[model samples]
Target: MTHFVTKRAPAVALLIALLLLPACAGQEAAQPTIAPTTGAAAATAADTVADAATVATPLPATVPAATPLPTATLAPDPATVEAAASPAAPTAAATRTGANYVLSLPREAAVPADWLMNPPPDFQTRSPGPGDTYRFACLELPARSTGLATVGYRSLEGLPSVAIEYAVYPSATEAGAALADMRQAASDCIEFTIGEGDNAIQAAFAPLDFPAHGDDSFAMALTTSGPTTGDLLTHVIKIQRGHVVIGISHAAAASGPLPDTALTESLAQLAVEQIDALTGE
Candidate 1:
Protein backbone atom coordinates (compact mmCIF):
# COMPACT_ATOMS: atom_id res chain seq x y z
CA MET A 1 0.00 0.00 0.00
CA THR A 2 1.20 3.51 -0.78
CA HIS A 3 1.45 5.89 2.17
CA PHE A 4 1.04 9.65 2.06
CA VAL A 5 2.17 12.18 4.65
CA THR A 6 -0.66 14.42 5.77
CA LYS A 7 -0.12 17.71 7.56
CA ARG A 8 -0.06 17.43 11.32
CA ALA A 9 -0.64 20.34 13.65
CA PRO A 10 3.05 21.03 14.17
CA ALA A 11 4.58 21.71 17.54
CA VAL A 12 5.02 25.29 16.26
CA ALA A 13 7.34 26.27 19.07
CA LEU A 14 9.66 23.30 18.61
CA LEU A 15 9.86 23.78 14.85
CA ILE A 16 10.65 27.47 15.26
CA ALA A 17 13.48 26.76 17.67
CA LEU A 18 14.99 24.08 15.45
CA LEU A 19 14.86 26.24 12.28
CA LEU A 20 16.82 29.00 14.12
CA LEU A 21 19.97 26.91 14.64
CA PRO A 22 22.57 27.85 12.04
CA ALA A 23 21.68 25.90 8.90
CA CYS A 24 24.29 23.51 7.59
CA ALA A 25 26.34 26.12 5.77
CA GLY A 26 27.78 25.41 2.32
CA GLN A 27 26.16 21.99 2.15
CA GLU A 28 25.78 21.34 -1.56
CA ALA A 29 22.26 20.54 -2.71
CA ALA A 30 21.91 16.90 -3.67
CA GLN A 31 21.44 16.24 -7.34
CA PRO A 32 18.20 14.53 -8.26
CA THR A 33 18.89 10.79 -8.32
CA ILE A 34 16.99 7.58 -7.84
CA ALA A 35 17.49 6.45 -4.25
CA PRO A 36 18.57 2.84 -3.83
CA THR A 37 15.66 0.64 -2.90
CA THR A 38 15.77 -2.81 -1.34
CA GLY A 39 12.17 -3.74 -2.10
CA ALA A 40 8.90 -2.21 -3.17
CA ALA A 41 8.85 1.55 -2.59
CA ALA A 42 6.60 1.47 0.46
CA ALA A 43 8.32 -1.51 2.06
CA THR A 44 11.80 -0.07 1.74
CA ALA A 45 10.70 3.15 3.38
CA ALA A 46 8.93 1.18 6.11
CA ASP A 47 12.09 -0.82 6.86
CA THR A 48 14.13 2.33 7.09
CA VAL A 49 11.60 3.76 9.52
CA ALA A 50 11.88 0.67 11.72
CA ASP A 51 15.66 1.03 12.02
CA ALA A 52 15.67 4.57 13.44
CA ALA A 53 18.01 5.17 16.36
CA THR A 54 17.04 6.95 19.56
CA VAL A 55 19.36 9.20 21.58
CA ALA A 56 19.14 10.84 25.00
CA THR A 57 18.66 14.59 24.97
CA PRO A 58 16.13 16.53 26.89
CA LEU A 59 13.66 18.43 24.72
CA PRO A 60 13.94 22.19 25.13
CA ALA A 61 11.14 24.20 26.64
CA THR A 62 10.54 27.95 26.88
CA VAL A 63 11.84 28.44 23.36
CA PRO A 64 10.98 31.72 21.67
CA ALA A 65 7.81 31.82 19.57
CA ALA A 66 9.60 33.34 16.57
CA THR A 67 13.08 33.39 15.07
CA PRO A 68 14.72 34.76 11.92
CA LEU A 69 15.10 32.31 9.07
CA PRO A 70 18.63 32.15 7.68
CA THR A 71 18.72 33.74 4.26
CA ALA A 72 20.60 32.04 1.44
CA THR A 73 24.07 33.43 0.78
CA LEU A 74 23.10 33.88 -2.89
CA ALA A 75 19.63 34.16 -4.28
CA PRO A 76 18.70 31.98 -7.22
CA ASP A 77 17.51 33.50 -10.46
CA PRO A 78 13.71 33.11 -10.33
CA ALA A 79 13.39 33.10 -14.10
CA THR A 80 16.03 30.42 -14.57
CA VAL A 81 13.60 28.36 -16.64
CA GLU A 82 11.38 30.11 -19.12
CA ALA A 83 7.80 29.28 -18.26
CA ALA A 84 5.73 27.43 -20.82
CA ALA A 85 3.24 29.70 -22.57
CA SER A 86 -0.29 29.88 -21.16
CA PRO A 87 -2.95 27.41 -22.23
CA ALA A 88 -6.13 28.32 -24.11
CA ALA A 89 -9.47 29.05 -22.46
CA PRO A 90 -10.58 26.59 -19.78
CA THR A 91 -13.73 24.44 -19.98
CA ALA A 92 -13.76 24.04 -16.21
CA ALA A 93 -16.93 24.23 -14.13
CA ALA A 94 -18.26 26.96 -11.90
CA THR A 95 -16.09 28.66 -9.33
CA ARG A 96 -16.30 27.84 -5.64
CA THR A 97 -16.45 30.85 -3.34
CA GLY A 98 -15.64 31.45 0.30
CA ALA A 99 -16.41 34.56 2.31
CA ASN A 100 -13.73 36.58 0.52
CA TYR A 101 -12.30 34.30 -2.17
CA VAL A 102 -13.14 32.32 -5.29
CA LEU A 103 -11.51 29.08 -6.55
CA SER A 104 -11.80 26.41 -9.26
CA LEU A 105 -10.02 23.19 -10.21
CA PRO A 106 -8.75 22.63 -13.70
CA ARG A 107 -11.27 20.74 -15.77
CA GLU A 108 -8.42 19.24 -17.72
CA ALA A 109 -6.07 18.80 -14.77
CA ALA A 110 -5.06 15.35 -16.09
CA VAL A 111 -6.22 13.63 -12.96
CA PRO A 112 -6.44 9.88 -13.53
CA ALA A 113 -9.88 8.31 -13.79
CA ASP A 114 -9.63 6.31 -10.58
CA TRP A 115 -7.93 8.93 -8.47
CA LEU A 116 -9.98 10.25 -5.58
CA MET A 117 -9.81 13.94 -4.73
CA ASN A 118 -10.33 14.33 -1.02
CA PRO A 119 -10.43 18.00 -0.17
CA PRO A 120 -9.69 18.99 3.40
CA PRO A 121 -12.61 18.91 5.81
CA ASP A 122 -12.19 22.46 7.03
CA PHE A 123 -11.26 24.00 3.70
CA GLN A 124 -14.22 26.35 3.66
CA THR A 125 -13.70 27.83 7.11
CA ARG A 126 -9.91 28.03 7.36
CA SER A 127 -8.03 31.35 7.12
CA PRO A 128 -4.32 32.15 6.84
CA GLY A 129 -1.86 33.78 9.25
CA PRO A 130 1.74 35.02 9.16
CA GLY A 131 3.77 32.19 10.62
CA ASP A 132 7.38 31.28 9.83
CA THR A 133 6.61 27.58 9.86
CA TYR A 134 4.59 28.10 6.67
CA ARG A 135 7.85 28.75 4.83
CA PHE A 136 9.09 25.29 5.78
CA ALA A 137 6.34 23.76 3.68
CA CYS A 138 8.41 24.58 0.54
CA LEU A 139 5.92 26.20 -1.91
CA GLU A 140 3.97 28.34 0.57
CA LEU A 141 2.94 31.94 -0.19
CA PRO A 142 3.53 34.95 2.07
CA ALA A 143 0.32 36.97 2.29
CA ARG A 144 -1.99 38.55 4.85
CA SER A 145 -5.70 37.76 5.20
CA THR A 146 -5.33 34.56 3.20
CA GLY A 147 -7.29 31.35 2.91
CA LEU A 148 -5.96 27.84 2.27
CA ALA A 149 -7.60 24.79 0.66
CA THR A 150 -6.12 21.44 -0.27
CA VAL A 151 -7.20 18.38 -2.23
CA GLY A 152 -5.51 14.97 -2.15
CA TYR A 153 -5.63 12.46 -4.99
CA ARG A 154 -5.14 8.69 -4.98
CA SER A 155 -4.79 6.41 -7.98
CA LEU A 156 -3.61 2.92 -8.89
CA GLU A 157 -1.70 3.66 -12.07
CA GLY A 158 0.97 6.02 -13.34
CA LEU A 159 2.15 8.57 -10.75
CA PRO A 160 -0.42 7.50 -8.20
CA SER A 161 -0.14 10.37 -5.72
CA VAL A 162 -0.58 14.13 -5.66
CA ALA A 163 -1.83 17.01 -3.51
CA ILE A 164 -2.65 20.62 -4.38
CA GLU A 165 -3.35 23.68 -2.29
CA TYR A 166 -4.95 26.97 -3.29
CA ALA A 167 -4.09 29.95 -1.09
CA VAL A 168 -6.22 33.01 -1.78
CA TYR A 169 -5.05 36.43 -0.76
CA PRO A 170 -6.95 39.71 -0.71
CA SER A 171 -5.47 41.52 -3.71
CA ALA A 172 -3.27 41.03 -6.74
CA THR A 173 -0.56 43.22 -5.24
CA GLU A 174 -0.36 41.14 -2.08
CA ALA A 175 -0.40 37.91 -4.07
CA GLY A 176 2.42 38.99 -6.34
CA ALA A 177 4.51 40.21 -3.43
CA ALA A 178 3.76 36.98 -1.56
CA LEU A 179 4.91 34.96 -4.55
CA ALA A 180 8.20 36.85 -4.63
CA ASP A 181 8.61 36.43 -0.88
CA MET A 182 8.15 32.66 -1.22
CA ARG A 183 10.66 32.47 -4.05
CA GLN A 184 13.18 34.29 -1.84
CA ALA A 185 12.27 32.07 1.07
CA ALA A 186 12.92 29.08 -1.12
CA SER A 187 16.39 30.46 -1.70
CA ASP A 188 17.02 31.58 1.89
CA CYS A 189 15.72 28.41 3.47
CA ILE A 190 17.62 26.41 0.83
CA GLU A 191 18.49 23.94 3.51
CA PHE A 192 17.41 23.45 7.12
CA THR A 193 17.26 20.79 9.83
CA ILE A 194 14.02 19.24 11.01
CA GLY A 195 13.37 16.89 13.95
CA GLU A 196 16.09 15.61 16.30
CA GLY A 197 17.68 12.37 17.53
CA ASP A 198 16.88 9.28 15.42
CA ASN A 199 14.28 11.18 13.45
CA ALA A 200 16.54 13.98 12.28
CA ILE A 201 16.13 14.70 8.56
CA GLN A 202 18.34 16.96 6.46
CA ALA A 203 16.14 18.95 4.08
CA ALA A 204 17.09 21.03 1.04
CA PHE A 205 15.35 22.70 -1.89
CA ALA A 206 16.39 23.64 -5.44
CA PRO A 207 14.62 26.27 -7.54
CA LEU A 208 13.05 25.25 -10.87
CA ASP A 209 11.72 27.16 -13.89
CA PHE A 210 8.29 25.99 -14.85
CA PRO A 211 5.78 27.62 -17.17
CA ALA A 212 4.14 30.47 -15.32
CA HIS A 213 0.51 30.06 -16.32
CA GLY A 214 -0.58 33.05 -14.33
CA ASP A 215 0.79 36.55 -13.75
CA ASP A 216 3.81 34.82 -12.13
CA SER A 217 4.95 31.45 -10.85
CA PHE A 218 7.81 29.64 -9.09
CA ALA A 219 8.83 26.03 -8.95
CA MET A 220 11.29 23.84 -7.00
CA ALA A 221 12.17 20.34 -5.87
CA LEU A 222 12.58 19.55 -2.15
CA THR A 223 14.22 16.49 -0.61
CA THR A 224 14.02 15.37 2.99
CA SER A 225 15.63 12.16 4.11
CA GLY A 226 17.11 10.59 7.22
CA PRO A 227 18.20 7.30 8.71
CA THR A 228 14.59 6.57 9.52
CA THR A 229 12.92 6.87 6.09
CA GLY A 230 13.71 6.69 2.42
CA ASP A 231 14.49 10.01 0.80
CA LEU A 232 11.33 11.78 -0.37
CA LEU A 233 11.40 14.32 -3.19
CA THR A 234 8.55 16.75 -3.75
CA HIS A 235 8.17 18.85 -6.90
CA VAL A 236 6.33 22.02 -5.98
CA ILE A 237 4.84 24.47 -8.51
CA LYS A 238 3.39 27.77 -7.35
CA ILE A 239 1.29 29.99 -9.65
CA GLN A 240 -0.12 33.43 -8.91
CA ARG A 241 -3.05 34.90 -10.86
CA GLY A 242 -4.32 38.19 -9.56
CA HIS A 243 -5.38 37.63 -5.96
CA VAL A 244 -5.16 33.84 -5.88
CA VAL A 245 -2.22 31.47 -5.62
CA ILE A 246 -2.16 27.79 -6.56
CA GLY A 247 0.47 25.45 -5.13
CA ILE A 248 0.94 21.93 -6.42
CA SER A 249 3.04 19.29 -4.61
CA HIS A 250 3.33 15.94 -6.41
CA ALA A 251 5.41 12.79 -6.02
CA ALA A 252 5.15 9.28 -7.38
CA ALA A 253 7.06 6.08 -6.67
CA ALA A 254 7.18 5.49 -10.42
CA SER A 255 8.82 8.86 -11.12
CA GLY A 256 11.90 8.24 -8.96
CA PRO A 257 13.34 11.11 -6.85
CA LEU A 258 11.85 14.02 -8.81
CA PRO A 259 8.53 14.50 -10.52
CA ASP A 260 8.52 14.42 -14.31
CA THR A 261 8.79 17.96 -15.61
CA ALA A 262 6.27 17.49 -18.41
CA LEU A 263 3.70 16.05 -16.03
CA THR A 264 4.01 18.90 -13.57
CA GLU A 265 3.88 21.43 -16.38
CA SER A 266 0.61 20.04 -17.67
CA LEU A 267 -0.83 20.22 -14.17
CA ALA A 268 0.28 23.82 -13.91
CA GLN A 269 -1.21 24.67 -17.27
CA LEU A 270 -4.59 23.35 -16.28
CA ALA A 271 -4.54 25.28 -13.02
CA VAL A 272 -3.43 28.52 -14.62
CA GLU A 273 -6.20 28.42 -17.19
CA GLN A 274 -8.88 27.65 -14.64
CA ILE A 275 -7.62 30.40 -12.35
CA ASP A 276 -7.63 32.85 -15.22
CA ALA A 277 -11.20 31.87 -16.01
CA LEU A 278 -12.22 32.29 -12.37
CA THR A 279 -11.21 35.92 -12.24
CA GLY A 280 -12.12 36.69 -15.90
CA GLU A 281 -8.51 37.50 -16.64
Candidate 2:
Protein backbone atom coordinates (compact mmCIF):
# COMPACT_ATOMS: atom_id res chain seq x y z
CA MET A 1 0.00 0.00 0.00
CA THR A 2 2.93 2.25 0.31
CA HIS A 3 3.48 4.73 -2.56
CA PHE A 4 7.22 5.32 -2.13
CA VAL A 5 10.14 2.90 -1.71
CA THR A 6 13.60 3.30 -0.07
CA LYS A 7 16.61 3.20 -2.43
CA ARG A 8 20.23 2.11 -1.95
CA ALA A 9 22.87 1.82 -4.71
CA PRO A 10 26.55 1.49 -3.86
CA ALA A 11 27.40 0.41 -7.43
CA VAL A 12 25.09 2.74 -9.44
CA ALA A 13 26.08 5.78 -7.41
CA LEU A 14 29.75 5.08 -8.13
CA LEU A 15 28.99 4.62 -11.88
CA ILE A 16 27.30 8.01 -12.16
CA ALA A 17 30.30 9.73 -10.55
CA LEU A 18 32.72 8.02 -12.95
CA LEU A 19 30.71 9.10 -16.00
CA LEU A 20 30.62 12.72 -14.79
CA LEU A 21 34.42 12.87 -14.38
CA PRO A 22 35.18 13.16 -18.13
CA ALA A 23 32.50 15.82 -18.57
CA CYS A 24 33.87 17.79 -15.63
CA ALA A 25 37.46 17.57 -16.97
CA GLY A 26 36.40 18.91 -20.39
CA GLN A 27 34.44 21.79 -18.77
CA GLU A 28 37.37 22.89 -16.56
CA ALA A 29 40.02 22.62 -19.33
CA ALA A 30 37.98 24.73 -21.74
CA GLN A 31 36.90 27.38 -19.22
CA PRO A 32 40.12 28.16 -17.33
CA THR A 33 41.73 31.65 -18.11
CA ILE A 34 45.53 32.46 -17.88
CA ALA A 35 47.99 35.43 -17.11
CA PRO A 36 47.18 37.68 -20.16
CA THR A 37 43.82 38.27 -18.53
CA THR A 38 45.24 38.42 -14.98
CA GLY A 39 42.60 40.65 -13.47
CA ALA A 40 39.77 38.62 -15.00
CA ALA A 41 41.58 35.35 -14.11
CA ALA A 42 41.86 36.39 -10.48
CA ALA A 43 38.15 37.18 -10.36
CA THR A 44 37.18 33.86 -12.12
CA ALA A 45 39.41 31.76 -9.85
CA ALA A 46 36.93 32.09 -7.00
CA ASP A 47 34.04 31.13 -9.34
CA THR A 48 35.91 28.14 -10.75
CA VAL A 49 36.95 26.91 -7.32
CA ALA A 50 33.42 27.32 -6.04
CA ASP A 51 32.09 25.31 -8.96
CA ALA A 52 34.67 22.58 -8.46
CA ALA A 53 33.83 22.30 -4.80
CA THR A 54 30.12 21.81 -5.67
CA VAL A 55 30.91 19.08 -8.23
CA ALA A 56 33.38 17.26 -5.97
CA THR A 57 30.91 17.07 -3.05
CA PRO A 58 28.60 14.78 -5.02
CA LEU A 59 31.37 12.16 -5.68
CA PRO A 60 32.90 11.16 -2.33
CA ALA A 61 34.43 7.63 -2.22
CA THR A 62 32.64 6.42 0.94
CA VAL A 63 29.17 7.89 0.19
CA PRO A 64 26.47 5.19 -0.10
CA ALA A 65 23.22 5.16 -2.17
CA ALA A 66 19.95 3.58 -0.98
CA THR A 67 18.23 0.91 -3.12
CA PRO A 68 15.84 -1.91 -2.18
CA LEU A 69 16.87 -5.57 -2.36
CA PRO A 70 14.68 -7.99 -4.25
CA THR A 71 12.49 -10.13 -2.03
CA ALA A 72 13.19 -13.89 -1.93
CA THR A 73 10.46 -16.47 -2.46
CA LEU A 74 10.49 -20.10 -1.29
CA ALA A 75 9.08 -23.04 -3.19
CA PRO A 76 6.21 -25.23 -1.99
CA ASP A 77 7.00 -28.69 -0.64
CA PRO A 78 5.91 -31.70 -2.71
CA ALA A 79 5.45 -33.82 0.40
CA THR A 80 2.91 -31.37 1.80
CA VAL A 81 0.89 -31.28 -1.40
CA GLU A 82 -1.74 -33.94 -1.88
CA ALA A 83 -0.37 -36.82 -3.94
CA ALA A 84 -3.65 -37.56 -5.68
CA ALA A 85 -5.92 -34.68 -6.43
CA SER A 86 -8.77 -36.76 -7.85
CA PRO A 87 -12.38 -37.46 -7.00
CA ALA A 88 -11.56 -41.04 -6.19
CA ALA A 89 -8.02 -42.35 -5.64
CA PRO A 90 -7.95 -45.92 -6.98
CA THR A 91 -7.22 -47.93 -10.12
CA ALA A 92 -9.46 -45.71 -12.26
CA ALA A 93 -7.84 -42.43 -11.17
CA ALA A 94 -4.42 -44.07 -11.41
CA THR A 95 -4.93 -44.70 -15.13
CA ARG A 96 -6.03 -41.16 -15.81
CA THR A 97 -3.77 -39.09 -13.52
CA GLY A 98 -0.86 -41.59 -13.34
CA ALA A 99 -0.42 -41.40 -9.58
CA ASN A 100 1.91 -44.16 -8.39
CA TYR A 101 -0.13 -45.29 -5.37
CA VAL A 102 -2.89 -42.74 -5.21
CA LEU A 103 -6.50 -43.90 -5.49
CA SER A 104 -8.73 -41.55 -7.46
CA LEU A 105 -12.41 -41.50 -8.22
CA PRO A 106 -14.26 -40.08 -11.19
CA ARG A 107 -15.48 -36.52 -10.99
CA GLU A 108 -18.98 -37.92 -11.31
CA ALA A 109 -18.50 -40.70 -8.81
CA ALA A 110 -21.26 -40.84 -6.19
CA VAL A 111 -19.77 -40.77 -2.72
CA PRO A 112 -21.89 -42.21 0.10
CA ALA A 113 -22.71 -39.07 2.01
CA ASP A 114 -24.70 -40.75 4.80
CA TRP A 115 -22.88 -44.02 5.30
CA LEU A 116 -22.15 -44.92 8.95
CA MET A 117 -19.73 -47.46 10.37
CA ASN A 118 -22.45 -48.71 12.71
CA PRO A 119 -21.45 -52.33 13.18
CA PRO A 120 -17.77 -51.53 13.60
CA PRO A 121 -15.69 -54.58 12.66
CA ASP A 122 -19.11 -56.17 12.94
CA PHE A 123 -19.54 -56.28 9.17
CA GLN A 124 -17.27 -58.01 6.71
CA THR A 125 -17.62 -60.45 3.80
CA ARG A 126 -15.59 -62.62 6.13
CA SER A 127 -15.76 -62.66 9.96
CA PRO A 128 -16.70 -64.60 13.08
CA GLY A 129 -20.31 -64.15 14.21
CA PRO A 130 -21.55 -62.12 17.19
CA GLY A 131 -25.01 -62.56 18.70
CA ASP A 132 -26.30 -59.12 19.75
CA THR A 133 -25.67 -57.22 16.53
CA TYR A 134 -26.14 -57.98 12.84
CA ARG A 135 -23.65 -57.08 10.08
CA PHE A 136 -23.10 -57.80 6.38
CA ALA A 137 -20.41 -57.23 3.75
CA CYS A 138 -20.10 -57.98 0.01
CA LEU A 139 -17.88 -57.27 -2.97
CA GLU A 140 -19.27 -55.90 -6.22
CA LEU A 141 -17.38 -56.68 -9.43
CA PRO A 142 -17.42 -54.81 -12.68
CA ALA A 143 -18.90 -56.14 -15.91
CA ARG A 144 -15.40 -56.15 -17.44
CA SER A 145 -11.96 -56.93 -16.09
CA THR A 146 -9.18 -54.69 -14.71
CA GLY A 147 -11.52 -53.03 -12.22
CA LEU A 148 -10.68 -52.24 -8.59
CA ALA A 149 -12.41 -50.64 -5.61
CA THR A 150 -12.28 -50.93 -1.84
CA VAL A 151 -14.59 -51.10 1.15
CA GLY A 152 -15.63 -47.48 1.77
CA TYR A 153 -16.61 -46.59 5.31
CA ARG A 154 -14.88 -45.01 8.28
CA SER A 155 -16.41 -46.41 11.50
CA LEU A 156 -19.78 -47.15 13.16
CA GLU A 157 -21.40 -46.45 16.53
CA GLY A 158 -25.03 -46.08 15.62
CA LEU A 159 -28.34 -47.92 15.10
CA PRO A 160 -27.91 -47.97 11.30
CA SER A 161 -24.94 -47.62 8.93
CA VAL A 162 -23.89 -49.14 5.60
CA ALA A 163 -20.61 -49.94 3.83
CA ILE A 164 -20.01 -50.78 0.17
CA GLU A 165 -16.97 -52.62 -1.10
CA TYR A 166 -15.97 -53.40 -4.68
CA ALA A 167 -13.31 -55.59 -6.26
CA VAL A 168 -11.44 -55.26 -9.54
CA TYR A 169 -9.86 -58.40 -10.97
CA PRO A 170 -7.57 -58.27 -13.97
CA SER A 171 -9.22 -59.60 -17.09
CA ALA A 172 -5.86 -60.66 -18.52
CA THR A 173 -5.37 -63.18 -15.73
CA GLU A 174 -8.76 -64.89 -15.88
CA ALA A 175 -10.31 -66.18 -19.05
CA GLY A 176 -13.80 -65.41 -20.21
CA ALA A 177 -16.36 -65.91 -17.42
CA ALA A 178 -13.85 -66.76 -14.70
CA LEU A 179 -14.99 -66.59 -11.03
CA ALA A 180 -13.95 -66.47 -7.36
CA ASP A 181 -15.49 -67.22 -3.91
CA MET A 182 -16.37 -65.16 -0.80
CA ARG A 183 -16.56 -66.73 2.66
CA GLN A 184 -17.98 -66.23 6.16
CA ALA A 185 -17.07 -68.46 9.17
CA ALA A 186 -18.20 -68.58 12.79
CA SER A 187 -17.79 -70.13 16.34
CA ASP A 188 -19.37 -73.38 15.11
CA CYS A 189 -20.51 -74.07 11.56
CA ILE A 190 -23.84 -75.50 10.48
CA GLU A 191 -22.72 -78.04 7.91
CA PHE A 192 -25.48 -78.17 5.37
CA THR A 193 -27.91 -80.59 7.07
CA ILE A 194 -29.39 -80.84 3.63
CA GLY A 195 -33.19 -80.35 3.89
CA GLU A 196 -33.06 -80.84 7.66
CA GLY A 197 -31.62 -77.39 8.56
CA ASP A 198 -33.90 -75.70 5.99
CA ASN A 199 -37.17 -75.82 7.92
CA ALA A 200 -35.35 -75.75 11.25
CA ILE A 201 -35.05 -72.00 10.61
CA GLN A 202 -38.78 -71.67 9.92
CA ALA A 203 -39.48 -71.83 13.64
CA ALA A 204 -36.99 -69.02 14.37
CA PHE A 205 -38.04 -66.29 11.87
CA ALA A 206 -39.80 -63.21 13.32
CA PRO A 207 -39.75 -64.72 16.79
CA LEU A 208 -35.98 -64.77 17.16
CA ASP A 209 -34.08 -62.20 15.07
CA PHE A 210 -34.62 -59.83 12.16
CA PRO A 211 -34.65 -61.08 8.58
CA ALA A 212 -31.61 -60.80 6.27
CA HIS A 213 -31.46 -60.28 2.50
CA GLY A 214 -28.19 -60.86 0.63
CA ASP A 215 -27.17 -62.04 -2.85
CA ASP A 216 -24.23 -63.89 -4.34
CA SER A 217 -23.29 -64.75 -7.94
CA PHE A 218 -26.54 -66.65 -8.48
CA ALA A 219 -28.01 -67.65 -5.11
CA MET A 220 -29.88 -65.23 -2.90
CA ALA A 221 -30.15 -65.83 0.85
CA LEU A 222 -33.20 -64.62 2.81
CA THR A 223 -33.25 -65.59 6.46
CA THR A 224 -34.98 -64.43 9.64
CA SER A 225 -32.73 -63.30 12.48
CA GLY A 226 -32.23 -66.23 14.98
CA PRO A 227 -33.42 -66.66 18.63
CA THR A 228 -30.35 -66.59 20.88
CA THR A 229 -29.41 -63.17 22.31
CA GLY A 230 -25.79 -63.56 21.15
CA ASP A 231 -25.93 -66.08 18.33
CA LEU A 232 -23.32 -65.68 15.57
CA LEU A 233 -23.79 -66.73 11.93
CA THR A 234 -21.63 -66.45 8.83
CA HIS A 235 -22.56 -66.20 5.17
CA VAL A 236 -20.34 -67.82 2.56
CA ILE A 237 -20.88 -67.00 -1.10
CA LYS A 238 -18.95 -68.31 -4.11
CA ILE A 239 -18.74 -67.31 -7.76
CA GLN A 240 -18.23 -69.74 -10.65
CA ARG A 241 -19.39 -70.32 -14.21
CA GLY A 242 -21.73 -67.36 -14.38
CA HIS A 243 -23.35 -68.36 -11.10
CA VAL A 244 -22.94 -67.71 -7.36
CA VAL A 245 -23.88 -69.72 -4.24
CA ILE A 246 -24.87 -68.13 -0.91
CA GLY A 247 -24.99 -69.99 2.42
CA ILE A 248 -26.01 -68.82 5.91
CA SER A 249 -26.15 -70.44 9.35
CA HIS A 250 -28.78 -69.59 11.97
CA ALA A 251 -26.29 -67.83 14.24
CA ALA A 252 -27.56 -64.24 14.14
CA ALA A 253 -28.56 -62.97 17.58
CA ALA A 254 -32.10 -62.26 18.80
CA SER A 255 -32.11 -58.44 18.93
CA GLY A 256 -35.61 -57.34 17.87
CA PRO A 257 -34.05 -57.78 14.42
CA LEU A 258 -30.95 -55.70 13.75
CA PRO A 259 -31.55 -52.85 11.32
CA ASP A 260 -28.95 -54.41 9.01
CA THR A 261 -31.29 -55.76 6.32
CA ALA A 262 -32.63 -52.37 5.30
CA LEU A 263 -29.17 -50.85 5.46
CA THR A 264 -27.77 -53.56 3.20
CA GLU A 265 -30.39 -52.89 0.55
CA SER A 266 -29.63 -49.16 0.56
CA LEU A 267 -25.88 -49.86 0.29
CA ALA A 268 -26.51 -52.21 -2.63
CA GLN A 269 -28.35 -49.49 -4.49
CA LEU A 270 -25.55 -46.97 -3.85
CA ALA A 271 -22.73 -49.37 -4.78
CA VAL A 272 -24.39 -50.29 -8.07
CA GLU A 273 -24.84 -46.65 -9.00
CA GLN A 274 -21.29 -45.69 -8.05
CA ILE A 275 -19.75 -48.65 -9.85
CA ASP A 276 -21.63 -47.83 -13.02
CA ALA A 277 -20.46 -44.22 -12.87
CA LEU A 278 -16.86 -45.33 -12.29
CA THR A 279 -16.72 -47.98 -15.05
CA GLY A 280 -17.87 -45.49 -17.67
CA GLU A 281 -14.40 -43.98 -17.48
lDDT of 2 by residue, 77-106 (tens): 776565555355323443532122112221
Cα RMSD (Å) per model? 22.2, 38.2
Q: TM-score of model 2 relative to the true fold?
A: 0.29
For all predicted structures, in order, the TM-scores are 0.57, 0.29
Candidate 1 residue-wise lDDT, 1-281, digit = tens: 12232111011111222232111123211112223333223111111114468988987987768988987687655564334444444432344455223236543246766654432212433344445224344344332434555444434332335556566666888778777776777787788766668657677888776766788888777666655344556666778887777777765432254566786787778777666766665
Alpha carbon RMSD to native, model 2: 38.2
lDDT of each: 0.52, 0.25
Off by over 4 Å in 1: 1-96, 99-103, 107-109, 118-133, 137-145, 157-160, 253-257
